[model samples]
Target: MSGFNTSGVLSVAPARMLVPILLILMWYLGRLHSQYEPIVTSKVSSRLEEARKMIPSVKLDWPIPLAKDPRAAFNSSKLALLIEARPLPHLPPLILHMMAVIPPDWRFLFIGSNESIIGVSRAYSIKHQQVIGKLDLVELPPPWSIASKEDVFRLLTDSRFYDEFLTDVEWILKYEHDSILCANSETSVDDGLGWDWTGAARMGDGHFSGYGGLSLRRVSVIKRVLSFQARFNDSEPEDEWFGKRLWVLPGAKVASRFDDAIAVEDVYMERPMGYHIREGGGSLDKSVWGDAARRKEIFEYCPELSMIMDMKLERQRCPDDDGNGDREMADVQVTTAVLGEGDDAKALPNDAESAVLPPQPPPLPQPWKVSVTTFGSPLRTGID
Candidate 1:
């Protein structure tokens, strides 16, 4: 009887010990799972919310003229400013400066990444009706919203946002403006980096083809280009695409001329009247060049005539009371000299030397006016 009791007690003792050990193991696992699950859930939810916020609520009033038509509510005489912004700190002031350069009849359309910036832009548009038109703000979807982390990471680093922005630009052109003047608000030019008016003139005449800084055109072209629902690859740069298209369009013309004395290199140069600061820290050349070595090669090959001309023109136009007729016949002379001499290209200054380009002329005492005319029946049906 004593032996039986001892064996039973020993078995019971082991069973009690095993039960607690198993329970503890289960508790530890449950606690770990609970802790990690919430973290994963929160992270995913945050990303989703961010993605949702990035999509702009699009409101389109259609039947708007896609071509330059006299009967259209918006006229061809007006200019359309298409600005691509991406959460840069300096954009508001840049927009203000742009407003100062163009005619009051011009309209401003901004496309970019952040909704906050768009909100600020809309406010500016309302306050400066004489200078701004219907503000079409298009937000890019966040990078992480995609199923693949690789795609999300690629989008975060790549020009996918800019490419999408271009699509928005095409849409706006088809529905709103008669044409678009795609300009960079982020680049500042010096004698070494300004406009190549000669190149521009030559290109304008039909030899080479390009568009940068400020390009002007009509809406009919945009509609035709986008009708196929063609999507630009993220690898493709926006300016190059625009340049190629503008070069082929019939009746497309440039309103500004470049000259040397005007120091088109200066942001304050009277000719450009307004200047763009190449915001978002990436090189336009590098973005388009594809390879670092190739980019360097092209940068070395090209004379920085465009930058020089831009500064000179800005200097010439800055002092004009009205934004119109700031061009001087000397512009052609300067351009001819720069292109012919080749010496001027060598004379172009470095970034440090160019930094001395004069300050902007005193802010126009009055805010520049931007006026917009909206036409067409408002679209109430299925829209993207």
Candidate 2:
């Protein structure tokens, strides 16, 4: 001891340095692994669980009448189907046929303008099935007649409306169960050709066109997107607004099963779908089958649609849009703008391959001086 073992001290010094270095390397590796981990992580799962817990204990399998009469046997187990529409009467018979094909368990929740068209849709919905309950219609306020753009912004951004929208969202989320499924009247159906609707980019020099249809799972995702929209309240175009918001949410997936080759054209940049439909003065009737001739034309020109349909049916899986990856807002904006708009207003290609059309200007409001009947509430009547 008195000799002060310097050799031992020197040996111990290297061990002390090596221990800290090894600890640092281990810490760095742990961080790296976490950074590159898959998005469906424990954190995301926990968030979903928390969100679910926050919702009320509402029963999804509410009993509903099966046949046309409510007095008839309430045999169905499913509760509701949410369909977004504008002028509902114009909905195609094909859409009605598809709805009829659904198992007799679900009821329809039609969101659209409170017009006679809704009444027609309601009649159609209950024609084959029972009218368990009157359709719940959530009317969107018109954006055009506001005093100023700031007023429009205020309406969208107001926390009160945001809270209301959130309540509507939570109500829908509570109903999200295996028994409930959503279907839209409008989708890009393949015409039994060989055109791949799920392609990522367009092929020609003209405007790029793509499909905008989604699966049942996407309905819940859309609710989450609306919640985010309420939270952020950015005033972009509707579909673009919806797409951008979806891109930013954690683990949100998009349905991109449209022909990719035609959608990459530069002309599609300025226009986008939902923009024109919402802005352009047209009824849902005109929107649905308005371009039937065009669809036939495309099938004649590109007979590959029939082949594509067969492939799509065989695959028969929901599109892993956005590549099942965490998509960025920029990606959403870029993709939506490119895919939504076509070459020109009417020039926008319409076929059995693509459901989305380019943005159009909003309709001009009816003159305020005109005499009008005030049904229910003035605020609600004017907005529609």
Candidate 3:
């Protein structure tokens, strides 16, 4: 009995010691779990934060910026002036094309009548150009008319016109709606800026043959001439008036003949910077634009000329056409080729008095008509 009692006491003591050891083990395990739980939770939280950072958030109040003004990149002194009272359909395109071909440092101004101004400003491209400060549209008041060629001449010759409208302008590129710059031209418009006046050369060797249809003029030289001489009203055209004085004006670097011409008018050049088709080719010079081969070459070099010049399709050529772009009137066969029912198909005038009839006037030349919509969008004129 005593042995059994001692064994029981030893077993009980060992069991009691095991309970405390188990408790210690459990406390150690709980402490380790508590330390690792925060680490695991932090690792998960950090991963979630990194994932959230990968996605972008939207801000409702962000504002979009407008396109930068293009005129800031250009020289304010160089101005392109177009004065047209006629609401020509080609004005917007002609202006835009010129803007593209001319140096970017030049600004454009259109001083036009209400009809013409409205016609031009209706174009979306023209609106964009205005928004960017590259162009301006103005309607001249009374006593500053451009209704006729005489009126335009008077306006340009007047010194007050320049003082009022063109102050601070050093160079002026005067272009008509019928004129256009050739994109394929090897000579840039900037090269012509060196001369005081450069334009299409006239037919003869007259001094200062800078025809002003698509001409570049120096304002200082023009001001000098205007200071001393006033153009006689209803006299020669403004270009000629300026040319006559400009030739005699001291130290003016004017284009004298074809050698210095920047544009083609009556004379022909290999690759002129631009072309001035007078009255949309109704008054085209036979020397420059008459030859079939030369016309073909010009068209190939500058296909854009077709947009401004009056042109006929190849199939529209008259049956008796001459290769030189003219028809030999005497050689034309006006007689009916079809024979009558019998052999009495002799050539005859329809009326007995037809032989004595007065000569009829030639048909009016057709203008090259283009819709403003056809030019597609305005050229992307953003400077890189």
Candidate 4:
């Protein structure tokens, strides 16, 4: 004890205690840093918010196909066009242009957040007054607000929004704000988004590819994905999030060569069913949609551009057709498909087969009631 100085022993004991104190202080600082960092906090907050979100625990199984039934009703009702949007001057035109060209019969549900410039929808509806389709602009409130691109969480959970917006509607096409259907798009016999509608054999795995823009989702599939999307933690590149989340399902499949996503065969190779306005520096790199100078080039490939902003609410009668969009689109579809009955033609025997009247096509499917809603403001669209 005499050899070991008492003062030295006391100093050693204090040093050991300081080490624990420093560690405790460091742990507290680490959390404080995490709280202030927007990126770090956002990730944690989103996960927590996602956890708080209420995705129904129910499982949505694949609905049986009614293709064989003559009475089989396709999901023509409420083709909810869920347009992802942000605050952009061009947003209204983007919506209007596609609306003007695509069949007016389709229902449209616009999904945005507080940051999104969704006021245009109401303004357009008020100004035009004659546009059809139940155009609804919905700005989700906080904890559910998904109006920004960074709000990938909201987009992934959109099925829940759709659940509230669309009732009894079987199909929902989630198109980004930057997307628009080709004014003259079409699907030939074997060219329906890589689906013949005959069997899953031809269906492309859209879930693997992130082309949520053109992918058509049946409500059942939507429910399945929404239920699963809720439990999913990884949320980047929303389209791929859906692709990875939904594709694993028994019947979930997406087929498209759309940009910003993965896919099998290019569904509409050189000619996409729709257009995506994208940034530069990528495969098939060309400024599209967003570029003003290059818009002419885009128009060469997509006539829909010509219709944007140029749309007038008054019905302009087509010389060759009435002002009906469905009828006009059918003709355009037949013309653009480039192979509506090519297989039928090739299958025909070298000799003429007796003409058989194909069973009269069932009465045209009745159109569903279209409804559009806007938060923070009312969304009124279409002529009664």
Best by lDDT: 3
lDDT of 2: 0.36
| Candidate-wise lDDT, in order | 0.38, 0.36, 0.84, 0.49
Whichever of 3 and 4 has more TM-score, that candidate is 3
lDDT of 2 by residue, 247-354 (tens): 456774343423322121122221111111211122222322235454354335433223212222324333332322222232121122233355543333323334
Residue 335 alpha-carbon offset, candidate 3, angstroms = 7.7
Best by TM-score: 3
| TM-score of every candidate | 0.31, 0.30, 0.69, 0.45
- Candidate 3 lowest-lDDT run of ten: 350-359
For residues 139-235, what per-residue lDDT tens digits would candidate 4 score against the true structure? 6665664544556555445775656656666655555554556645553212333331111111254334445344554567657766654634444
- How close to the true structure is residue 18 of candidate 4, measured as C-alpha lDDT? 83
Counting clashing residue pairs in each candidate, in order, gives 50, 26, 0, 5
Candidate 1 C-alpha lDDT tens digits along 1-384: 123474466334566678889999999999999989989999999999999999999998788545453223333234344434434444454455444434443445554546545545655543554233323354445542323323333432333442454333321211111111123312222221232221122123233222234333333454444444343445444434444554455554322433321111112222232222232213222233345454344324332323312223435543322333222222111111233464454333223211122237666686556555445865444322
* lDDT of prediction 3: 0.84
* 2 or 4, greater by lDDT: 4
Candidate 3 has which clashing residue pairs, if any? none
Candidate 4's C-alpha runs over 4 A off are 1-76, 82-85, 113-118, 122-133, 150-152, 188-212, 228-234, 256-268, 279-298, 303-384
- Candidate 1, TM-score vs. the true structure? 0.31
